[model samples]
Target chain A: MPENMTHVPYYPGCTLKSKALGYERSAMDCARSLGFEMHEIEKWNCCGASFPLTKDNLMGLTAPTNILIETEQHCKERDIDAKLITLCSFCYNTLKRTDFAFREEPGKLKTLNEFLNREYKGNVTVIHYLEYLRDVIGFDNLSKMVKTDLSHLRVAPYYGCLLLKPQKELGLDDPEEPVILHDFLDALGCQVIDFPGQVDCCGAYLIMRNPDKVLELSHNILEEASEYGAQTIVTACPLCQSNLDQSEAVRGEMPILYFTQLLAVALGLETEQHQFESHCIDPKSLISSCKKFKEFSDAK
Target chain B: MQINTENNQAAIRDLEIATGETISDCYQCGKCTAGCPASMDPSPSLLIHLLKLGLFTKAVNSASIWDCMACLTCSERCPKNVSPAAIIEGLKRIHLNNMEPEINLNSLGQEFLAHSTQQAVVSGFRKFV
Candidate 1:
């Protein structure tokens, strides 16, 4: 490892360790290829999964606050910038919003710190991997690092809801019209398809209580992407990927991929890192076809 | 509509203090309802209207609050910056605080629990349970 390699704290939340292992694997590989290292934070807990909606419900804020304090400590130990990166959009939203809450109200921060018996100076910056790629690595530079020609693949970039919403808090992109995912696919040389349901919610936690509603909602996103001629749909949220991938309505019609998996493929990383078996819709056939097409063109 | 001025004032005060959002700021522009992806009956605007009219019980007990995905599109699109999503969430908090949680975790099928993502289960518990 280069001495100057940028080392940033990473929080994988719960899904990444279990259901979304591919997301973490591919993201780590991509970060390395892009000249950065994502060191997982020590003993990090879940970011409470959801931000507390009511002002009085400080209990929900505890888990994320503890994680933020841990990230700050990790940054100090590594002597790196006080920045924490997350691959899951849900974690990104919760952590960022929690940090925002603390910044907005010092009293809440003080209360949380006191409760946790830890100190967070409101110094750590929470960022999603997509934002790190765009702002830090620059898509132009990422374009230069692509090892495979993925232009044959027509891809739809799914933003989902948590990644960009409550604009005043997340502020990652225009919640109405986001371009980060589109720009990311462009950098990878894939033909990006702009679809209607790109930024819509995939029924999220409602999946547990109402799978039918999730299917209907996810089906709409898949149908729209397919209508626009997309071969695959890539998303940043594990829950979004799972909801869309497992929907009985569009089960095998669209291959739902984590954005980092596509990035790993384009970077020419090992195929095993993608962990395609976890995906409900097998993306292997689609990826292999693209690979064959690239070989033919290269041989010519 | 029986105008219960006393009940209305208390409900409005409780909501405002809990959510830090002014329900009266909503002007029924319908932008929030237009962008909502979930099947919010009485719609986002009408829910706020119910609250504004001091029909707190009607707003809280409506099945629409449970149907909300909390996508925040309604909150983002609100022209008055009322954050209807937060208000709806406040209603959910109130509902949960007052009543026994409608969705029991043990009652959920084992297959569903096994297949679902952790975030879904965690957030489901946070919101519904």
Candidate 2:
């Protein structure tokens, strides 16, 4: 609560509040460590989880638009910049794309605003927390803050689909060959691995309808990461984490973690903040092993 | 496989309106199919081809529509920017509007429901239901 500390409006979405508490907790803690406060938007609703694919589905745009309006008000009340940070990749994509849609079609914005009895000037810039780290806080500064040596752990940065698809809209990174996760992980002192399944789909929402196909897809991603000698896999999407973590075929073989959790660890935050137990495949042992090796080598 | 030009034209027009992508822009480059990880049969290119050939019914009937994960790899790889992924989603919207949801929430086992993330359940209902 220092006077000069930056205040960033945040949207936790549905998953972060319910299933992805670890992702939320770690991200907030890391933001504080990095000298920024993530202010949650009061009375924010769901970002609809998935962006409505149909061009005519303005009804689907309402949920995220409401969240954006709330973010704008949240920033206004605090006298901060109109930037809303999202943790969940799905929420990031939905809110970002919703903002993009309104920008593309001002008429649609007018229709939605009039219908909802609210005015959103499209002033809010929706960004993922990773973007904030890379853009706002340079990786150089982040590397300087790393208190733990994670060089012993080889991590795979999984982009999945939401973070980098439909490049025209999201444009977070190269949808084909992304390096933000690599750069972020590198700054954390971990060895980053480049794997094929990094940007591939982990069967996404298909898990609900076709769990078998999801298993096959998630298994393929895990196998590829394992083949690349990755000791752990880090992702930005809650659904991707769940699908990859719940792969019955390779359960407990590879621990799938949110990128923020690893950031919390590298920042030397309290263990409870990472919420390791919430993960389907607990990464506590893997993380502890890495720490133990660091200690053992230091002792040598 | 009788090709009904009328229905095909209507379907194509509907899809263009829904997705805002020109169907004729696709030239069957196969890059979308090659890059797809979902193992979609009657691949994305083939579905676009079917629409071009006035085989709207066949394209709509293909089970591959459901198999699409909406990863947007095909859409991103398309040289013509046809966004076959969006087209497939448009097809899904059309299909869903006409039929009952294929997934029954009650039929899902308790364990699966318990472990699935809220994002999955919400997005699952959005896409499947």
Top of the candidates by DockQ? 1
Candidate 2 Cα misplacement greater than 4 A, ranges: A1-3, A248-252, A292-300, B1-6
Interface Cα root-mean-square deviation for all models: 0.9, 1.0
Cα error, candidate 2, residue B4 (Å): 12
What TM-score between 0 and 1 does chain B of candidate 1 receive? 0.90
Q: Candidate 1: misplaced stretches above 4 Å?
A: A1-4, A248-251, A292-300, B1-6
RMSD of model 2 against the true structure: 2.9
lDDT of candidate 1 over A1-300, digit per residue (tens): 346768878999999999999999899988887889889999899888888877778998999988988988888887888999998888999999999998999999999888888898999899999999999999999998787879889999999999998778988899879999999999999999999889989999988778889999988888888889998999999999999998833555678999999998887777686699778778888877655235544755
User: Please, what are the lDDT tens digits per residue for candidate 2 over residues A167-252?
Assistant: 89988999989999999999999999999878988999998888889998889889889889999999999888888988933654
